[model samples]
Target: MAYGVENALAVCCFMTPEYQESKNCQKELLYADEQNVPIIPCRIRSDWKPSSWLVPELPTKQFAHLAISNKSKSGVLRKTFLIGNTHKELTRKTAHGNTSEWTFFVRPPSSDRDSIETYIKRIRVYLHKTFSPPLVILDRSPFEITRTGWGEFEIRVIIEFQDEWHHEDLEIFWNLTLRDNESYEEVDVEFDSYL
Candidate 1:
């Protein structure tokens, strides 16, 4: 059944394990509620919860990326390398429909830093499985990968360096969310730091 925006909400009347895994069901549901109104996903045997970050009345799209900095010193070379961690988060809930994209990036402090790119490239190869596509690195300036999903979830990022002294890679598990900044006070405070 086609769900109208004015219908208040859409409740999955029936949910089968097969249906849950099918791409058709996801596409249909995405179309059914393009405006991103609170959708009551199938509860037949699922524990999925609607995203709390979205507020429909505001009618706005959100695009924000979170960045984490990792610093390490090479004991052998006695030099320190700075790695900037960031993500690409995009959420669109307009008349067009509700869509989102989440990607992660690891790079040196500046665009012209080629030496640091070498380390980033090696880390990308080492953590290929962590990425969705698992592509090899041809450039080292920035290593990045994008994930696919309609709902928000936590993603694990592992960055390995070429430091002989440090044998372990830096691992980070981030929960990616995109929503109206005004609705979340913590998000507001975090954004303030960038400014």
Candidate 2:
């Protein structure tokens, strides 16, 4: 188990009383932790809670709950969008000591690109007050806002849609960082066909 965990990209542990109490399971989880491997805790029994010792071993207290039952369901449509930021240090610095260029963007999945582009009318980004024009409006695809800054701050983004879509404006907040790194958040939008 240790060898497998070491080689695996991620380990999915089905949490249960039996699995938690096992000495071997404990060792495997510890080993995974030592090696910096990602552990995905899944709760198989609805009534069971992770043991005290097990709680600290997992990355976060939140786990995916899997309730097994006999039921029938139909397919549902889902769309995922990637919202994130990328930043890089610039050789040139501003008078206020700003030294990095950062860009925050919202990218829809390839399959839904056309539909998202057609429905989204514009994007509004609100930056920190220190910026000359704190609010920016983008009226095209590749919704993004790029600027140079020296510190990290929260940015508010609003996605406006065409009137025909009849959808409320989507508001999201992103943390803008001044570093040579990139991060993304996955936003899932589910739609009911009957609606």
Candidate 3:
């Protein structure tokens, strides 16, 4: 929802029903979070207030994308999907009884070594969760590219749900690891979640 790099941010705070932190408000929150930029929270209960951080700036030339759809028609809140730089679109739908079937349009940027391992772990998680939805990339299975040297490349990431339970847990427990680029072996692992 933000348009420029000068005043851009992402709200990663938690909100209480007594104080609803709607999606619209988070965009502005993230903007101020950059560079200890001194942002006032929405004054909600349970918001993740940060004491400080080096400002994370959005790219000026290459803009980032955000695909966030908050409640379903029944008002059940779902997941939030964010990629630093990627293009996303909902591709196909099929009506069955009352619910709709789904396919997604995903084309992510080729990640550098800095984020490749992180991305791969996420990809593996999605695949296991959704059992590998009809991937947009037919020839190649979801894989990672390791950078042995100094260079950056973009890649695509796709996540599709098998049933109605999409990736919409307001807070999900997920596992993460840092690995060697070439070996793809886990160097470190941790489990954490956000709400």
Stretches off by above 4 angstroms in model 1 are 1-98, 111-114, 121-141, 163-166, 180-195
**TM-score of each model, in listed order:** 0.33, 0.55, 0.18
Q: Write the per-residue lDDT of candidate 1 for residues 1-195, one digit (tens) a residue.
A: 454444656434234444545666665556655655554443332323223322341234332222322332211232234322233334554353436554445543343444654443354332334444654342554465544434545545555555422335555554545442211111000111111
lDDT of 3 by residue, 31-130 (tens): 5544444443332223233222212322221222222233322333222233222121224422322122222212233342233323222342232232
Over the stretch 38-106, how does candidate 2's per-residue lDDT look in tens digits? 878888656678788887777464688865432323323455878889999988988878889889888
Indicate whether candidate 2 or candidate 3 has the larger TM-score: 2
What is residue 103's positional error in candidate 1, in angstroms? 2.2
Off by over 4 Å in 3: 1-74, 81-147, 166-195
Candidate 3 vs. true structure, TM-score: 0.18
Which has the greatest TM-score?
A: 2
Better of 2 and 3 by lDDT: 2
Superposed by TM-score, candidate 2 places the C-alpha of residue 165 at a distance from the truth, in angstroms, of: 2.2
Give the CA lDDT, 0 to 100, for residue 110 in model 2.
61
Which of candidates 1 and 3 is the stronger one according to TM-score?
A: 1
